[model samples]
Target: MSGILAGKRILVTGVITDASIGFHVAKFAQEEGAEVILTGFGRLSLVERIAKRLPKPAPVIELDVQNQEQLDGLEGKIREYLGDDASLDGVVHSIAFGPQGAFNFLEASWEDVSTAVHVSAYSLKSLTTACLPLMEERGGSVVGLTFDAQFAWPKYDWMGVAKAALESTSRYLARDLGAKNIRCNLIAAGPVKSMAARSIPGFEELADVWKHRAPIGWELSDAEPAARGVVGLLSDWFPKTTGEIVHVDGGVHMMGA
Candidate 1:
């Protein structure tokens, strides 16, 4: 328990597979001496299985950011494992989704767009608020994952817009929550070939950008760099940093065309 996250408790969401950034974040958090709890959306069993691969045993909690009931009951569920007065030192939001229609921006409907925004963007707010009570007294870090939404990418479409909203939401959360000593920040990572990437239409075309532009080079398979960024933000090392977007994309976000 001598690591940077020693004695801390962190809640990680959207862990569907070992290849996911969320999974790695959970793994690293535990390795750094933090107690990690995970939340799964649709496939609880799959998430539970993945959680077993972490450095230490982590309890899996069922959570759907869009589910009002689940959001309202999140603290209680977390308490079930950590006890009635359980507190969280950090929360990782690696959740995002968009219907197939969203990939075709022009043809996408409000239903598709709404679902994309709701789950990908709004959930940041909802999830953070849901965890507020646990963090209010002592304050903690809220780290979320984001693809660089500053530019449009092939097939990213509406999901890009949702990420934009997510980025903005983090800023406002930081602005409001800073008074409570809580920090909200995001890691804008490069693409990885995880289960979530497979869902994106023409994902390679998107990843291809990193291939040519990332000044330091990019690895579509390596998630450790990004996971480390999350752990860094969660630690006391960033005591004065909030509402920031740290790019862990091989410096791709900075390369100019």
Candidate 2:
């Protein structure tokens, strides 16, 4: 297939390593002819190294979503890199984080839960609005990565709460941005062996359930399909679709048996 995203300029956040889901999105976005820029939190060297793995090495910008200054200055920073006249075609919000103990509800503290909510959930709103200046008037798509948190999962704990909030945030964004022709959606992906997942206690057990329940079967290591789903939503193909949750979970979210 020819590139569905040709001439599109996209900003992708949360690229920490080659194993990152955002990394795959950036790589594939370039392959599909989109001009892609990346954002990293704290670890600039790590994101720089990961940027080398993309089809074309993309410039990495510093964006700690939790930091108000970073959020406030994102549009100008991105414009400086992409050129002052450039407008964004899409945004991939792959940023999320949770304290280790938050993965264990029984051991999680209020502070930790609030941190997770702020980082994993609220950051989507922050980052999206920060980049809205680049997307405003022109219209574009916003794709966020999420796990299925509508239902509970072992070891997912407060991160699950964060994901639920993330899902809700996407919908509200979709509603408000719809009149402007900006689409907001999310990919409810299955568990994959990413750096963040490794931090969760007993992630292996959660992986095992998908193997048995997913109709199309699920692999913990594969990220390509998930990346494709994200790009599709960001493409013109889903023009009328907003506030929707697209599942890239191998049909697991739909099955009851």
Q: Which candidate leads in lDDT?
A: 1
Model 1 segments more than 4 A misplaced: none
lDDT of 1 by residue, 1-257 (tens): 78999999999998999999999999889889999999998889999888888887689999989899999999999999999989999999999999999999899999999999999999999999999999999999999999999998888999999999999999999999999999999999999999999999999999999888998998999988999999999999999999999999998888876
| True lDDT of residue 107, candidate 1 | 97
Question: Hey, what RMSD does candidate 1 come out at?
Answer: 0.7
lDDT of 2: 0.90
TM-score per candidate, in order? 0.99, 0.97
List the global CA lDDT of all models. Answer: 0.94, 0.90
TM-score of model 2 (CA atoms): 0.97
Model 2 residue 82 lDDT?
83
Candidate 2 per-residue lDDT, tens place, 70-180, comes to 889988988898889989999999988888878878888998999999999998899889988899978999999999887888778899999999999999999998887
